[model samples]
Target: MDHKAKHILIVGGGYVGLYTGLRLQRALRRELKSGSVRITVIDPQSYMTYQPFLPEAAAGNLSPRHVVTPLRRVLSKVRIRNGKVTKVHHANRSVTFEPNAGPSEEIEYDVIVMAAGSISRTLPIPGLADAAIGFKSVGEAIALRNRVLALLDRADSTDDEEVRRRALTFVVVGAGFAGVEALAELEDMARDAVKYYDRLSEKDLRWVLVEASDRILPEVGPEMGRWTLEELRERGIEVKMKTLLKSCEGGHVVLSDGDAFESATIVWTAGVKPSPVVNAGDLPLDERGRIMTTTKLTVSGTNGAFAAGDVAGVPDVTNPGQYCAPNAQHAVRQAKVLADNIVRHLQDRPLREYRHKYAGSVAGLGLHKGVANVYGVKLHGLPAWFMHRTYHLSRVPTVNRKVRVVADWTLALFFKRETVSLGEIESPRDDFRAAAATG
Candidate 1:
């Protein structure tokens, strides 16, 4: 609060923003408590979600609440603001935030960290926006979880094959880490859900994976992609590659590969683009609309301004051919350097640069099935799946959340996944109407 205190304002509460804020608090514990420095984190969401666990959350393997780390409770030293930044006048060293339930408020800062992160990168496919749902965000994940369970319920009560097929047919477009893992996990669960319904059978349901490229899971290389295709095909899951979504109006998936399927569930996880917030203020953006930053994590042409993670187009000094891809792998590594350079700026020390090798990618395909490549070491089957859980559990923020997550896994070892779909929570209106009518 003091005039001389260096105020560090972080513009997001995601992988980079949350980690950086917490790191700063730990590193400057004495300074922050003494009011020598003030840290502020501005984000619309009150929590930072562990995105790698999203598939499990959607598949009922993990609770949504458990995966998200509350910003205030964890980063107790930082002042948390719940609002969207409508305008960022970085030139004036101030930003305007539009509260969720109130008018906009402005705050000034000595240093700003642009970590607004990426949004669901959508395409212009016809009727896709209305017909297809994205697989990001806690809301979207919970909604998809409900939709999946509800589809099973609808199928159980109906005798019509037409309706049954539509309800059971789940189409996932895009075979990236998100799309592939989602389809694999959800299908595994749906197949399990049908066991409780006498009317529904595993064979009756159809799962389709439509990818724009010839290979799925492009991050693990073509051979691994081919291996995944074979695995999917063996599971009786339709794997259509090099196909484009021509139209998906009314849940009818029309593809370029001469296939048209009727489905009630359509998930779009094709790609992601930087959020519009990158261009919201006066921040410099690259062609992809990502905030452009130097190797030292400093925003180009700005002294106290820096950025990293998905929203930042941080130069990939390790790879000359491209910038760092938008993934947690790069984001976490970037946060370490970003935090160091920020301290460097404070003490007039030379700023350290961010240079990380893409340590390969990992994907979980439900239980006992996964694909991973680390430092050119390829792993699959149960080993990859176990490694996947171990890696993420270790990376998930905070000791409290880590213990709970590990307990969730330990219990999973003794019992099957929870089938109870808290689907009603997705739409409280149903219960509200029931209560009103009963009253």
Candidate 2:
């Protein structure tokens, strides 16, 4: 690390932190003098995942690598550390990091930006934390893809009808964008994969979407949500609205509404809560557990301490009734302001508040179909779907990732999306062991 320069330590290399550091590098370079600054970004993963493309990655429409922006590559001027941040010392302006191998380290900073983002919000449902998978990062997306394809292989190879049926039955526990699109994309992929399996047919598989709400995609209004329900059901996906998964025991799911089913895939995208880091040191947080912040984006009761993204409950100015919902668009913009504020603070300048309106929600519903609500216009089916992909591909972090993503889509236009499940990627040596043992 460059000890001679002033350091701006940023926590969480997710949407906000990554983008904040990216802007800080450029802003600080133009905004600061030589030996004036060094921005250090610390997070467990070294890449920022473009979450919107995860459904496509799960469906094999975009290559997994194309959706991720490597922090080191993108933020060359910033020091990148791959580790978990344990504590923030506001008084001393230092942060404690627990590296994978080295003794716990502490780095003093002139300013700190809290952009740790959020984690998968899980309920206390039995067997969920252990058995259910999360839909937050690249690993889970890749894992879900692998599992979907593996289910087909397992169905094809198995002689037991019960086992095959269970293998083909997929349960996604949230009807939000992540849950809906993941289930939709994978279901489309799995259904196509049936052609390669002798025993497996589209009829043999089941995709169940369980939501506790009265309707799905609240951002898109009830009508569109109902239309989505019809569209999914028409495609053979069981949209179980007004219900939820009560438990997951021995790969069997118990729904809250007195129903049960056996399935190999259980994905939890119910929503997200603030990272415990926001309140880990007993920081001031709103009742909902998010760090309280002003529209200008500073922690409500603290000076020199800033929080944004999934953690900061910045009041939504446009909608008087609520706080800004934690989404990628807000996170990306807030990071820019947060970085600017930090730069101004360093120069003893005035800080600016954050303000933005909801641009509405966009969702990919597998293949050429999608759903979106921008400004008051609600859309469903193919047109919405095209807009969904177009919008996300445009904002996916970097030109490198953007080009690769566009190429992936362009190539996919000519080729049918790869429905072939590489589930064996989860356990690569399974095939070799069976043949060698039998031989």
Candidate 3:
């Protein structure tokens, strides 16, 4: 193989893209030194968010910026492109992309890595696209923290009882990890925030969690899942099982079980589908629109093309006849092996297959409350909450972020979590625009 310059293009800047680029940067030392290899990372966002910390961040337990790692700062050697890949032609090793603010252009590469992550899989319920908020991004988490506190303020100031009731009632759909943790954290924050308002007592506020499945946290096993359900119910959270959100038109929430109520806030955390990137490319995709890959992490039946993480349906060696589950743990581990395989391919060496045994799951249910099932050992309450924090603390991207997260927790030990909501952050320029128009 000629040692001429070889360009490798990575699509998406999420967990898989970021980790794979970083690994390549480390592994291709000689190639990089000789200027024989060039790596470019493309994504809509310039930063990678640590998704597990989003719940804590939403609860004001951590700063929003601390949860995101800037791609340029971390991937120094790799070129960072802030854009979306509009189309991929793997047969020709070329991609057409549109930058954040520019015309679409095409680029050819020697190798292509598809790391486009998933997005919220939503139903076409009435008023959902306009009213309900998703719990996936940093913006959503920060907005939620502000919105939750603002709801309390609205309830306390309203004279109409119906208005107060609507403002105080919060509905969360989906009971998976994202849904459960988000509901728990916000519930905890609201419980703590209400104490300051004399007009808003604990009884005045209502929290509802709706799950389509028979139970929540299926990864934690039925025993722990039931325990979590009971624990959530014991905290006065209305856990509606085997129910679906019919609609949230104008904050009037309707459920599948013939229940209807008025809620000012409805958080959607149900599930995610493969990002549209899979559809943008010509690669072979599963019925669900996920790129199909072999156990070795290469795009099925294609050379010089690879994929991993939420967007790729990589055959699961441990489970057999099934693909790997989409989660941070799997994405991270798969990225390491994917990076190694890419380097091996370039070096004309054999690639290693990727396999991982399930390590169990952990979840935080409000302060000092959680559930975990590690290696078949089920734990509940404070111990599980501690494990939830400890495990994620270790996995969070950089050391700087880890320290900031720990500091947030340490300060919480002494000082209270800041409940003040500058909801104006959402529309900081609104006042200025109004003033300018009046002037």
Number of the top candidate by lDDT?
3
TM-score, prediction 2: 0.95
Residue-level lDDT of model 3, residues 1-439, one tens digit each, is 3456899999999999999999999999788778899999999999999999999999988889889999999999999999999899998889998999989999889999999899999999998988799999999999999999998999999899999999999999999999999999999999999999988898888999999989899989999999999998988999999999999999999999999999999999999998887898789998878998989899999999999999999888999888788999999999999999999999889989999988999999878889999999899999999999999998888788889889889998899999999899899999999999999
Which candidate gets the maximum TM-score versus the true structure? 3
Please state every model's RMSD to the true fold in angstroms: 1.4, 2.3, 1.5
TM-score of each: 0.97, 0.95, 0.98
Better candidate by TM-score, 2 or 3: 3
Residue-by-residue lDDT tens digits, candidate 1, 1-439: 6798999999999999999998888888998988999999999989999999999888877878889999999999999998888777989999988878887888898899988888888888888999999988878887888888888898888888899889889999999999999999998888888898887788988899988887899898877778878888888999988899999998888999789879998999999888778877898888878887899999998878999998898888888858988899888888888988888899899998888888887789987899888788888888888889988998999999988887877787798877666777766799789999999
List, residue by residue over 1-439, the lDDT tens digit for candidate 2.
Answer: 3466677788889888888888888887853447668778888888889888888888898999998899999998888888877887777777788876689988887767788889989989999977799988888999999888877887889899899889988999888878888989988888777887777689998889999988887767777878888899999998888897889977889998898978888999999988878766645778998887888788777667788899888988888869888888899889888888888887889998787888888888888888888888988889999889888877888888888988998998898777666666778899999999999
Clashing residue pairs in all predictions, respectively, total 0, 3, 0
Off by over 4 Å in 3: 1-3
How does each model score on lDDT?
A: 0.87, 0.84, 0.92
Candidate 3, position 437, lDDT: 100
Error of 3 at 415 (Å): 0.7
Candidates 1 and 2: which is better by TM-score?
1
Give the Å error, residue 89, model 1.
1.2
C-alpha-based local distance difference test score of model 1: 0.87
